[model samples]
Target: MIVRIMGEGQVTLDDTSVIELNTLDDELLATIQADDEEGFRRTLGALLDGVRRMGTPLPDDTLEPSELILPASDATLDEVKQMLSDDGLIPG
Candidate 1:
């Protein structure tokens, strides 16, 4: 799966990484629901860090469509809330 971090380029992640991301996605959703700013920031940072660690960065020239689009690192809680869906940013 190709994941895109808004304001950043895309990264190619495998199934295992996707699964891990899904777990983090759940945490993110929970943080949002609980209105926990610290948790949200921590989970969001973890999610992004996981992607960077477990996935391969796509070349700038690559144009493949992304399967998931995550908020930018500096995104506000309200902005992240706006980005959430029933399945969250990364579907389980």
Candidate 2:
């Protein structure tokens, strides 16, 4: 799955679903700026859960050619962590 933050308060999902959460986004940024790690995580989780409830991914067979992709290459745990830390999402 791929997640992209389009702007301060908008999140675009695979170029299909565009969601606007201005209030939530502001709160998240505030928490992040204040170094409230738990608050940041909770808000992020809620945003993620909202998208998941929308059924972003239909099914494997329903995806278009551009949406389909191979799995990530095998890597050590630390390597994967570093990769994720460097980029929020892996390239498709």
TM-score of each: 0.89, 0.41
Residues 1-92, model 1: lDDT tens digits: 99999899999999988887888989988888899999999999999999999989999988788889888999988888776744466553
Q: Pick the candidate with the highest TM-score.
A: 1
Model 2, span 1-92: residue lDDT tens: 33332221222254333235334545655665566767766765665455455435544444243321211223233443344356623231
Output candidate 2 Cα RMSD: 9.2
Question: Which stretches of candidate 2 lie above 4 Å from their native place?
Answer: 1-20, 58-92
Error of 1 at 36 (Å): 0.7
Q: lDDT (CA) for every model shown?
A: 0.87, 0.42
